[model samples]
Target chain A: MHIAVEEEKCVGAGQCVLAAMEIFDQRDEDGVVVLLDAEPPEEQHAAARDAAAVCPAAAIAVRE
Target chain B: MSAPSRVVVVGASAAGLSVAETLRRRGFDGQVTLIGEEDHPPYDRPPLSKQILSGEWPEERVWLRDEATLAGLNLDLRLGVAALSVDPADRVVVLADGSRVTYDELVIATGVRARRLPGTDGLAGVHTLRTLSDARALRETLAAWPRLVVVGAGFLGTEAAAVARAMGAEVTLVSDLEAPLSDVLGAELGELLVRVHAEHGVKIISGVVVREVLASGGRAAGVRLADGRVVEADAVLVSIGSLPNVDWLAGSGIDTGDGVHCDEYCQAGPGVWAAGDVASWIHPAAGGRMRVEHRTNAGEQGMAVARNILSAGHPAPFAPVPYVWSDQYDRKIQIYGSPRGCDRFAVTDGSLAERRLVALYGRDDLVRATVGINMVRSVRAARALVATPTPWDSIEQGVTA
Candidate 1:
C-alpha cells in the first residue's frame, strides 16, 4: 500500500506516528508529518491505513 | 473519491462544529453527521460566565452557528444524542441507543466537565457552571440567594464572583493558593487579581482549602475550611477545575493519559481524532505536551483537524499563536503565546498601578509572551513580538516591525 500526505493541511498532532511509527514520523523542528515510506510491505498495510485514518487533520492518504 | 467519505463528529461544541464546517467548506461532500449530547446547537461558551450570567445577553445569543449555517453546509446534525463508544477498528461510532454509525473519519470533541467537591453530598445551594443547564440553574438561584461563596479563585470563579457582586449579592472568593491564579499566571499577577477582587468588594480568602460543605436540612449552609474556619453563605460556587471527558475511551485502545494524546496534527489513531479540551497536543513552539482549554484554541485546532482529514498526504502542521482572554469587572485581560520559563517582565506602554497596561515576559534574552490589561493596541504589538524573538530592551522600548 502507498500513502500520500498533504503537507499543507497537516498539524503536527502526532496521532499517525502513535498508530504506525514505521510508516509516519514528524519533523523534529516544526513537528510536521514526515511519511517515512510512501509504500510499505503488504504486512504493514493495515498500520499504514490506520495511520491515515487517525490523522486529526486527515492529512494522510493510503492507497492499495 | 467515490463519494465524499462519511465523517462522524462527536460533540457539537466549538471543536466539533468547527471541524464539520471546515470539512464542508473544503469541498467534502460526503455525508457529515454531527452528534451533540446537548439538545441545543453549538453555542459560544465564554459568554456564558459573563454576559449571560449578568442577563446582558440572552441564552440564544450564544448560539454559534444557526440552523441556516448547518443547512447551508448540507450537514446532518444529531442533537441530544450522546455517543456511547467508538470502535476505531470498525470505524463505527456507537450512540447512546446502541445504534452504530460507520464513518471514514471521526472527531472527538467531548470537552471537559467541572470537578465538584467530593463528600459535599447533600448541599442544597451548591452550584457548578459548565453547561447551559448549570448556568440557568445558577441564574435562578442567584435571584433567591443574596450571598455567594465562590470556591477557587480561577478565571471562572472570579468571573462568577464579579457577576454575582454586580447583581448586588455578597461574594467571597476562596482559593487554596496564596493568591488567585497563582498556579497559572504566577504569584505576581495572582496578587493583582486578589487585589482587584478586594477592591470590588469581593472578599478574598487565599491559602485555604475547603474541607467540606457544612449543610443543614439537605441544603448548603456554608463551607468549612481546612483551617477550621466556617464561612456562612446562602450558596456556594465550586470552580475548582475540569476533568477531561475520556471515560468512553477506557477500552478503546487509543493511548489515553490525562487526555487523548495527539500529535501536532491533532490525530489520535486510525480513523479517530480529538480536539478541544479533550486533546493533549504537543505544542510545536513549546516542544512540550499540553492541553489547551481556551475557546480560541478549540476553534483553531478543530479547523486544523478538519483540513488534515480532507487532505491526501501529510498536511502542514497546525501551529497557531496561542491566545486566551478573560473578562472580569471592567478589565479585559488578553494573553498571547505560552508564558513558561519566563524570568523577567517589562512594562512597555502603561503603568501597572493604572491597571491598563502591557507587560512582556522574556527568557534567554528573547520575548516569550505578553499579557495586556485593557490595552488592545499594545496587545497586538505584543503578539508580533511573541511571533518573532525580540530582545527585552527592544520590547521595553515599544519596538515593532
Candidate 2:
C-alpha cells in the first residue's frame, strides 16, 4: 500500500504518529505530518490505514 | 458480559458511537440500537474551539462519520431520543418518548455538560461553548471583532482567546490560577503556555477571579473581578470546565458519583459498560478512579469496552498512557502519560528561552509524563519511556539545560 499526506491540512493532533509510527512522523516545528514510508509492505498496511483513519485533520491518505 | 444478540448504546457522541461502530467492526452483527439526545449525528468536538471557532473548517468537516457511512452500518440510530433511565434487572432502556428498548448489552456514554458560571446565564453576550451551536454562534460574532473576555484560562479559554485573536478581536483571559493549565500540566509548562498566549496578544490576567458579570442594557457589558476591578468587554465566554452527565442514572443502582464508577474494563456491572468523559473508572497507572474528558480517551476507551464485552472480560485492562493535545495558534501542546504526582522536570530538547521543547516529568525516580512544545518526535519517543520510565539521572544523562 502507498501513503500520502497533506501537511497543510494537519492540525498536529499526533494520532497518526501514535497509531503508525513506522509509516508516519510529524514535523517538530508545526506538527505537520511527515510520511516515513511512502510505500509500506503488506504487513504494515493495517497500521498505515489506521494512521489515516485516526488523523483528526484527515490529512493522511492510504491507497491500495 | 458475553456476546449478545442485541446491544444498545446511549449518547451518540464519540464514545457511544465508537462502541457501536467497534461492535460492528468486531463482527457483532446483532441488532444494535444507538440513541442520542442531540438531533444531529456524531461529530468531532476537538475542532469546535480550534478550526470551527476560527472558521477555518466548515461545520460539516467536523462530522465524525458521513450520513452514507452511518446508514451503511445498519444500526438503529435513534437520534433526538433522550434516554430517561436504564433498568438493569430487565436489561431495558427507557426513553423520554415513552418507549422502552430491551437489550442484551448496554453501553452508557452520556458524556459531560459544560460548567457555566453562576449568574452568567440569561444574560445576552454571555456563552459557554460546548455544542456546535455555541461554536457557530460565537463564530458569527467574530467577524465584528468584539471585545471577548474568556474566563478560566484552561484549554477551552485559551483556545477561545486564540480563535478570537485570529479573527482580529481583542481577547482578555481571566484565570484564577497563576498560570494556565498548571493544575493539570506542571507549573513550568503552564507558565510557558501562559507566555505563548501572552505573546500572541492575549491579555492574560492571572491570579484573578471573575466575581460577577456586570451588565448594561440587559446585556453583559463586562466582568467584575474579585479586586473590584471591571474589565470592559462586549462578550464573555465562560469556559471553566465540564461536569459528567450522569443525572439520568440517578436511582438506577448502577453506581455513580462524579461519574459512573466502573472497573478497569469500563464495566459498571453485569451486561453494562461505560466509557468516555462520563466513566470514572479505576486507572491502573494512577491507582485511583479518574474520568478523562479528552477525545482520544473517549475513542480508545470505547473500543476497549467493546472488546471486553465481546470477549467476556478476556481482554487486557484499558491501561492507557494518557495523551491530550491542544492547539492555540501556531504552537501546539501535546502531553502523554499521567503528569500527576510528578515532582521533578527536565527539558530534553530545546529550552524555555525559545519556549519550544520536550519536557519530561518524573516522580519517585520514574518518568510520569512528557509535554512537548512543537517537538513532535521527542513526544512520540517519550511514549516508550512511559512504559519503561527512566530514573532522574538516567533521563538527564545528556540533557542540556
Candidate 3:
C-alpha cells in the first residue's frame, strides 16, 4: 500500500502522527504532515488507513 | 453474544462515514447501510466555514471521499432521505420515504442543526451555516460583498466574519460575550481574538443581545440590538449555536436529553449506539458527560463505536483527549483538550504579545487542556500533560515565564 499527503491541505492537527508515528510525522516548524513511509509494510496497513480516515482535512489518501 | 451480521448507520456525515469505513477496514463483511439526509455524499465540514466559504476551494473539493472511493466500500448508500423514527425493541428504523430497515446493530450519527433566531424563518438574506447547501448559498451571497452582520461570537460566526471581511465585504461581528470566544477560551484569549479581527477591519460589537432581525420588503435589512440600536446589513448570519438532531428519536425509548445519552462505551442502549455531535456520552478521563462538536472527535468517536460494535461483548471505553481547531484569517488556533470552566490558565511558551504561544488550562490542580496560537509543536507535546492531567505545580515549575 502507498500513502500520499497534501501539505497545503494539512491543517497541522498532528492526528496522523498520533495514529501512526512509524508511517507519518509532522514538521516542527508547522504541524504539516510528513509522510515517513510512502509504502508501508503489510502489518502497518491498518494504522496507515486509520491515519487517512481520521484526518479532518482529508489531506491523506491511501492507495492499496 | 456473537457479532451482528447486519449494521445500519444513520447520518452520512463525517462520523457516520467513519464508522462505515472503519467497519469495512476491520474486516466486517456484514451488510452495511449508510443513510444521509443531504443528496451529496459525505463531506468535510471544517472547510465549510473557512476554505469553502472563502471560495478558496470549490464545492467538489470538500467531499470526504470521491464517488469511486466511497463506492468501493460496498455500502448500501441512501442519500436525500431522513430517518423518521426508530423502534429499538423491534430493531427497525422508519425512513421519511415510507421504507423500513431492520438491523442487528444501529449506530446513530445524526449530528446537530444550526439554531435559528426566532421569527427569522424564510427571511431572505438571513442565513445559517451547517450543510453544504447552506455554505453554498452563503458563499453566493458573499460574492456581492454585502454589508454582512454576523450575530454570535462563536467559532462559526467569527470565522465567517473573517472570511467576509477578507472578501472585501463590510463585516460587523456582534457577540453577547465580552469578547469573541471568551466563554470558552477565557477573556484574555478572547480579547486577543477580538483584537485580531479588529485589526483586519471587522467592526466588533460585544456585550449586546440581538433583539430581532430587522426586515424590509420581505428581506433581511439588518438586526436590531437589545440596546435599541440597529445595525443595517445586506446579509445577516444567525450563528448563536446548534441543537442536536435528536427529534426523530422522540419515542425511541433511548435517552435524548442534551444529545443521545450514552455510556463511556458509546452505547445508548442494547444494540444501539451514538456518535458525533449528537452523542452526549460519559467521558472516563474527563469524569463527566460531555458532547463535543469538533470535527476530529466525530471521526474518532465513529471509529471507536465501529470497533466497539465488533468487540464481541468486551467493548472498550471511548475516552479521547478531544481536539478542536479554528482558522480565522492568519491564525491557526488549536486546542488539545476541554478548556471550558478551567480555573487556572498560564502561558507556558511564547508570549501573547506576539500572538503566538502555548497556554495551559488547569482545573482541580491538574492540567486539563492546552491552547496553541500558531505554536503547534509545543501544543502537540502538551497533550501528554492533559492526557494524564499532570499537577498544576509541576507544569508551572517547568514554565520559564
Highest lDDT, which number? 3
Strongest candidate by DockQ: 3
Q: B1-401 in candidate 1: lDDT tens per residue?
A: 23338999888988988888778756788899999999998877777788788877777767775577567888788898888888888888899977899998888899999999997754679999899888887888787747789998888999999899888889888999876786656556666777888988999888889998878788888899999999988899999989988888788798888889988778887777888889887777767788888876777788788988877656556676777777788877777876656777677766667877777777888888887777764565568888776777765655221
What are the per-residue Cα lDDT tens digits for candidate 2 across B1-401?
A: 45588889998998987888778877889998999998889988989998889888878987777787799788999989899999999999999999999998899999998998888778889988889998988998777899989999888888889889989999999999876788778888888888878888988888988999989999989899999999999999999999998889888899999899998888999888898999999987778898898888888888888888789658667888878888877777888986766898888888888878888888888888888888877787877887675666678876766
Give the C-alpha lDDT of model 1: 0.79
What lDDT tens digits, residue by residue, belong to model 3 across residues A1-64? 9899999889888898888989988776577888989999999998898898889888998998
- What range of 10 consecutive residues in model 3 chain A has the weakest lDDT sum? A25-34
Name the docking class for model 1.
Answer: incorrect
Expressed as tens digits, the lDDT of each residue in B15-35 for candidate 3 is 999999989989999899999
Better of 2 and 3 by lDDT: 3
Question: What's the DockQ for every one of the candidates?
Answer: 0.02, 0.52, 0.67
Full-model lDDT for every candidate = 0.79, 0.85, 0.92
Candidate 1 vs candidate 2: the DockQ winner is 2
Better of 2 and 3 by DockQ: 3
Better of 1 and 3 by lDDT: 3
Ordered by TM-score, highest first, the candidates read: 3, 2, 1
